[model samples]
Target: MFKIMIVEDDPKIREIVLENITKWGFDGLGVEDFSEVFNTFIKYEPHLILMDINLPSFDGFYWCNKIREVSKVPIIFVSSRNTNMDIIMAVNMGGDDFIQKPFSLEVLMAKMNAILRRTYSYTSVESNIIEHNGAALNLKDSTIIYNEHKLELTKNEFKIIYLLMKNNGGVVSRDKIMRSLWEDESFVDDNTLTVNINRLRKKLADIGLDNFIQTKKGQGYIIL
Candidate 1:
């Protein structure tokens, strides 16, 4: 079942939203601690988020940007602030849609369903996670977990590891890796690629994954 996370601070609204979400046959996760919204998000890995603009610690826009840095999960801003600028800011911050407060639960459900359909119609939930040799890489958050130790990865590190792990046991040439990096709009030369590989290796080693990536002589790199 698709899970939706509610980040509203009002108890009444949260309760109502949760009820309607359950009624619509979707699992609902309500946030109790506003301070750890991002952490809660990582823990649950909800498919969609209902965020309020006037949050306690940080506003919805801040949290939205934070989530965007890791995952492209669909976010809908549900807030009382209906200013034009507020709506524009929501979109600028990567929110998929903006719904004004005091909205009909039915309309909310409709929007939720629409976003879910458009977002997941082409992809499975498991596609966001890739695992290799007991190490799981979260494509959503640019983080990898091995032996219960989680390490956040930089953009370069993530792309490099993702390619290697996806093509597990096969040599990926340095040229191919550089091309991938270039495709990501990160212009990295041969030396930069080497630097990124070395750093990634050290991070893997830190998580008890020593020598996880093997060098294939003059061909390229491989994860065996």
Candidate 2:
């Protein structure tokens, strides 16, 4: 089942939305700690987010931008602020849609369904970017951007990082990586894999992402 996370601060609204989401046959999560919104997002990895503009600690826009740094998950701004500028800013901040406050639950569900369908229906449509921990790897260009600095990757480097980032937060065994490389027609022995991994780590460190990929001894590598 698709999981939807609600980031609204209002208890009443959050409760109502959660109830409706359950009725709509989707799993729902509500954020209780506004201070740890981003961390919560990382842990839940929800398919969609419902964010309110006026949130504690940080506004919705701030959290949205932060989340966008590491994910392309669809976000919808549900707020009382209805200015044209608000709508424009919402779109600019990577929100898929904006819903004014006091919205009908039915309409909210409809918009959510539409976005979910468009985003998840086509298996062939892959996002050209994969992001984690403030770094974005561009699949189209074989480059990684972090802290406003961009660095190009060699073919092997790109393939390794791509595989790791695609499985971020999970251990990718050495054997699995080698098999992937073999399937790509670039056969590499164990020693070569170590060299490539070291090189990639150096490049990532140069871009200020030190220890981005962690070694799970007796297991393999992982990007957390």
Which of the numbered candidates is closest to the native, going by highest TM-score?
2
The number of clashing residue pairs in model 1 is 1
RMSD of 1: 8.0
Q: TM-score per candidate, in order?
A: 0.64, 0.67
lDDT of 1 at 43: 69
Give lDDT tens digits, candidate 2, residues 103-168. Answer: 999999999999999999984334566778767787877988776577999888888899899997
lDDT of 1 at 202: 97
lDDT by residue for model 1 (115-221), tens: 99999898887547666776778877899877557899998899899999899678999888898887753555568888889999999999899999888889999
lDDT at 203, model 1: 90
What C-alpha lDDT do the candidate models reach, one value each? Answer: 0.88, 0.88
